[model samples]
Target: MKRHITGLFVLSALLTIMACKKSVEVLTPSGSDETYKVPQGNNDYDNTIVDYYNKYGTYMLYKFTEKDVYWTPTGWKKPTLPNGTWTTGAEVEASDSAYINAQLNLIKNKWFGFYTDKFLKKFLPAKIMLCKKVDSVFTNYVFTPTFTAVKGTKKVAAFYNYDNIQVNYGDATVNSMTAAEQRLFIYKVNLIFMQSIYARGLNAPTAEFANSADYNTAMTTYAQAYGKGIIIGYSNITAQSDWNAFITAMVTYSAPQLNASVAITDQTAAGILNTTKDPSGQIKRRYNMVRNYFINEYGVDLQLVGNATRGL
Candidate 1:
């Protein structure tokens, strides 16, 4: 009996040792994990991306998969059309390596050159996915006048020709863009930057502008709204709506253009000039307020950025 009890104690000790060893092995971290690793290459393009990452804390991804583009919680999935057809939703192809240098130069000259280092560091998105093409296809169903189905057809929509900051550079190379395209490119980049400012609630309108009765009235037409210090009509009158309208005005017109419009006395209709011109001095007041906010808060003039995009 004494020998048996001693053997049992030894067995229990061995089991405990085995369990502890298993726990240690399970808890150990792998040194080769690439989950958070930043990709690097010896080429100049890769080096440029690394430099941007180091400087602005932004990842300029040129070579990435479709999953990188659809990175929301739901993630990438094949879409089922209304006609009961399973279709590939959106395709985000990797950018052509040959245009990397030209693309980088365009970004540097048109985008980064417009904003100060401080502003870009603060507001730039963490990840910028550069791609050659982003396209989507949908089923186009035709219906007869009597509500009968005629036929269903698939239509392809190409979005590579435009410059979208959301997708970075599309297939349209910098050299291939026409004069109009370049202007649009500048305008879009500037517009996205302004949108980022609004999203962050940075440089927002003051209480005086946001809460003023003159600026928040319900109007039937654009002219009526302009007279009341409002630039555009709003279905929902809230602080957020007011800010959106103000931002729309900022992106739509430059300082010189606004000033020119405000000075116009000639009217296309009685008591009203063209929609682009503001006669009541109300729009001017709001413009100055918005323009001053950016200058004072960010030490950057939004009008200058606007004027630059306007090709002034």
Candidate 2:
């Protein structure tokens, strides 16, 4: 009886050791991770927020064409002033609609259709917003293998935490309201999409890809655009409050109104003659308020980027 009992104890100890070894193996690094391609099935990568945006984000961006032309009075008019110059609302709407439709078609037929699979089905029905401008917009499409969504919401808050790396045209400026506003518009839209990804119970991908020096550089470059690039009208970002305010205003108010065809000429001319706030400059405050908040709340060490020139 005593011998049998001892053998049983030994067997239990060995089993426990084997189980622990298996657990350790499971937790070990997946051997110098690489961008593992999906075999077009139910892979986790296929369902990631990044992939969803890659396939559908552009389509969401293109939808703004409808909202864009409508937002500007002259946008819906036809163009007779010049071939490129917008003249009438009808023509403007038609022209823009054509381009937008084509963009939508590409997303639906080329991007999303190409990648449909079981994984995607689990996370369909997402909201997407398009920023008409901003260089880092491409980040919407880049794939990241690992990410965690907010605990309870489908909004991807990870972007708020990711290092504010900037990318192409590092710290550059734009020439016109139409151009500058377009970027602001795009930024707002992207945030909406981020929210959608979060709502789906998926977190935006984390900076885990930072393990790769190349990807790290890419992320840094992508972030720099927002931190250093021309901020359309605002001058600097000093705190998190600034970022929140800017994002709120951009998403809720500014984005829907800034479009290509509006001839603020009437207002612009009035400003030139009266020496008043460049009507554009008046709206500039909404932007300034955001930058100020960033400086105060976020602690961006670098000087803020602004319109007209690179002012603090």
Candidate 3:
């Protein structure tokens, strides 16, 4: 997927932009603290984001103008400072509202609705920018897909670029992506959330599935069947990579998909990779660990969520 594990150095500065190099009160596009009603619509992305703002308030990053903004899920378009150096918004046009809302609704249902509903936590990013175009920010949009506020005690921000990916349908979202695109998108999202501060509470299993003999066998079978790309790949060496790998397992790969992906050379290999045949008695140890974490910590069942998301 042309991906890497650590994105901290790349996107953390995004939060700085959200803070405007200093903390500012939650200012609406009008740059006023007065009550700005969240725009109402059937769009899940807009509604969920508005709901977030209603409860917690949104910090206006930039009063952007020029480029088409992706609404609230990405970043500021062309932010200017207060001293006439620049200003925040370009002024919202009533005519474009319908089209913008349509695109945003597609994005929300495709990928973000999952987070709004499944990411049950209080430590959400204070600022969210759904950029109108990829180049609206200081850096190139390709390298910055989803930036989240996750570093230090400072404020947090999450951004999405609308032009980052291509689509055939007039309506596009996570569901509209190709099989491979969907997988990569899900993987990236998992990594983004997994590396965030909210995911810091996740503790890798030490005993439940860590018996030396059993782990050794699992690793051996995994490597032998999958040829080392599945478990211990390039993006899985970081401190949180293990958890990332686990999330990838739970969300991206189902039990049957995993078992079938294995190259069955022998009964032992087959047994180790197969949940029905595993002698360790845990068909999907990695998946089980992650599933338990969500259920135990967030009261959300990963199996149901995964199945629904993956169309399992």
What lDDT score belongs to each candidate, Candidate 1 first?
Answer: 0.58, 0.31, 0.40
Backbone-clash count (model 3): 16
Model 1 CA lDDT for position 244 = 62
Please give the TM-score that candidate 1 achieves against the real structure.
0.66
Can you tell me which runs of candidate 2 are displaced by over 4 Å?
Answer: 1-4, 16-20, 23-181, 184-190, 193-247, 250-312
lDDT of 3 by residue, 16-91 (tens): 7877845555534665433234553445445655665666454222223334343334465444443423323232
Decoy 2 TM-score against native: 0.23
User: Which candidate number maximizes lDDT?
Assistant: 1
Query: What is the alpha-carbon lDDT for the whole of candidate 2?
Result: 0.31
Alpha-carbon shift of residue 131 in model 1 (angstroms): 1.4
Off by over 4 Å in 3: 1-48, 55-97, 115-118, 132-191, 195-230, 233-240, 264-283, 303-310
RMSD of 1: 9.1
Higher-ranked by lDDT: 1 or 2: 1
Q: What TM-score does each of the candidates earn? A: 0.66, 0.23, 0.44
The residue pairs that clash in candidate 1, if any, are: none
TM-score comparison, 1 vs 3, better candidate = 1
Please, what are the lDDT tens digits per residue for candidate 1 over residues 130-215? 66654454544445554443323232212221112344354556568766566566666666666655655555557866755364
Model 2 Cα lDDT, one tens digit per residue, 1-312: 999999999999999999999998888586653322222234342344345456533112222243432232223321233432333222111113223333333334322332234323433343322222222211112235645221121111112111111111101122122544434423433343334334444432223211211212232221232233212223332333233334433333332233223332332111211112223343344444443443454342111111111111
